[model samples]
Target: MCPCGFLLPIHKGETLPSSLTVRRCDLQRFLKVIRGAGLLSRKGIPAWVSLDASSGVLRLRAANTQVEVQLQLEAADSAFEAIVDAEFLKICSGKEASSVTLSLADDEVTASWFDADVPRAARFVLRSSDSVPPAVAAPEILATNEPHLLEALREAQATTDPGASRFALACVQLRSAEGRIAATDSRQLLVQRGYQFPWAGDRLMQITPVFGAQEIDRSQDVQIGEAGNWIAVQAGPWRIAHAVEVEGRFPNVDLVIPSPSSLVSSMSVETGDARFVLERLDKLPCSDTLHEPVTVELNGSVAIRSRQEESAAAVELVLSRTQRNGNECRLQMDRRYLGRALKLGLREVGFTAGGGPCVARDAQRDYVWMGLGQENTISAADVGDRLLSEESVGG
Candidate 1:
């Protein structure tokens, strides 16, 4: 018997005819796809794996008051509808087998696996309350063949709020008029634009940053659709739907973004050097009270400095081209947040200072704007003079 009280009918020498049967390989493939869709729930409300033989599709669905994931797989054969614990069916499919047969008799559903050397089988008695979830209506098609949609979602994921206080910042917002996707966690904002999609209206949906990372094949074209309160994505054979919640408004991120003309000092650094500096800064003790601000000084060259309670460190790099507007500028910002932009692996990263927020981006449209710290406006000359005075005193 399975852990969920699924009886092994074949072990009892019963010969119940199967109403639906398919190859073991096909069933395994379906399980893998649904598992990657983030629909395999094990606790709280029971996770159900429902088979609709009438429609020739299998489904795994789980929902809470805030989130819902419904994944469907094509090519399932069954005579009647059967719903069982998702984990139980996954285990049954995991057995060594060449083919698997499913039998629906009364409220009990039997799963039997056949192999060249041995045959194994298990049966799950459905509860009276167990029923298949109603199918979601087909959503309106928004965009297709857009590769940057996933990229934008990935970048926005870095800025989404994981806590419950700011409910709206936890979702990625798609703006139809601007053709962009954006997200923010109050401290940082990431926006990706230039998506060639025929969007009819704006849509906001809550989706995990990790969604579609493992489920969708990069080579296949992708489609985005919306209906009711859900957004559906179909990439190749993989499909994912996210239920929308929390209708709160996203902050006006454009107000925080500094214009390029307003920058006092701008510099460009190799991607490798930028990543190295950020990684080294990450090792230093960070200040929780002020969010570990890393100071960048641009004069003749570039210098990155950070201090954690009296332990101070600095890294100097000559691998940059600088444009100074008759004044050396220094900007302080959160090191970790800044690192997220630098790690994007762009060939060259453009950094702008003396702005409301520090801006970093590549040649393309990808960009990240990080909040400036309280003591953000120190001049590079002032920092140099202070360091010299301190060294003289120590001497």
Candidate 2:
């Protein structure tokens, strides 16, 4: 068996033999790559695993409809290719063994493992099946800063509506010329800048599979490649390719962001105080996670309370150091939306209070959400009156 030093990529249409053998540790590493690339869709999407000895080392490729990942390892015997349930490799790799052999024959693929130390041998078999076409080759290479890429991916996810019927709303728009990534769920918009992809020019790519972004290694610089409507991300030994949404244009996020002159008053709040209030709200019942109304006042004092009548356990939490420019104002929104922004590791939150859209901005990222309308807003005086009444009743 030849020693495998580094894993190299394998393209489609490679010559393969009938059987191959790999150490248990190498098999486990392959499984980890599969898990990180998010090729195994919860919708039971099957994956294709193929091996090729054309590269001198054993090149293993795994792919589903939306993603494809490739890696190489040392192996004994000839190469083989097979299409099976996406979970097959995971189960095979989990078995207790020192080494595993994979063979293809009789319209089926078999995984055999033996632990000589334990004096036991076991095998699992699954019938081979057909799979979709291979992923497009990503040849154009573009270097990206790790921190910028990760920040854009995470901020865009907060605004993407994965279940949206429209492809644009369900994806993160990568506008290279603008040097920013944007996503909107219609109710809110999040824009993250500082990305430069000069190779893409004015082109826009809508990335649908955002989960792969989480698997990127932070220690290494991220490499991006593009071919047709597909984008590839490669870091170290892991390479993840995803299909970009091509049907629609992402809404212009810049049009909606509040301008400085339009913002009347703004105040900063400690993230710890915000978290404490959110924890109290989480105890109450919420019929709609995305639209459950929660009102916040940044006038003379800071206070938050759930607006749903069904949540009888709701309580108003007044915060410290919430005082602002003496202007009295209140903003009502879904607590879930606020929670998403706060979870971005922001130390403080700044709110733009005026007769304009609800806008929140931190150092690098900006958050915007629509209010629940006048019918849902409770005046500051009314809140004070209600709190005093509750205290009297308790006494």
Highest lDDT: give the candidate number: 2
Q: Give one digit per residue, the lDDT tens place, for model 2 in 170-245.
A: 6777767666677888888887766666365544444444333444466767677776667776666566666676
| Tens digit of per-residue lDDT, candidate 1, span 132-219 | 4455555666578565566666677667885746558777777767767777887777777666444566666777644535544557
Give lDDT per model, in order. Answer: 0.58, 0.59
lDDT of predicted model 1: 0.58
Clashes of 1: 0
**How many angstroms is residue 295 displaced in model 2 relative to the true structure, after the best TM-score fit?**
1.0
N/CA/C clash count, model 2 = 0
Candidate 2 displacement at residue 342 in angstroms: 1.1
List runs of model 1 lying over 4 Å from the truth.
Answer: 1-16, 19-43, 54-80, 93-100, 114-120, 127-133, 140-142, 162-167, 196-199, 210-212, 278-281, 284-290, 311-327, 346-355, 362-366, 372-395
Runs in model 2 with CA error above 4 Å?
Answer: 1-19, 23-38, 41-45, 53-59, 72-83, 95-98, 104-108, 114-131, 163-167, 202-216, 284-290, 307-314, 323-326, 347-356, 379-395
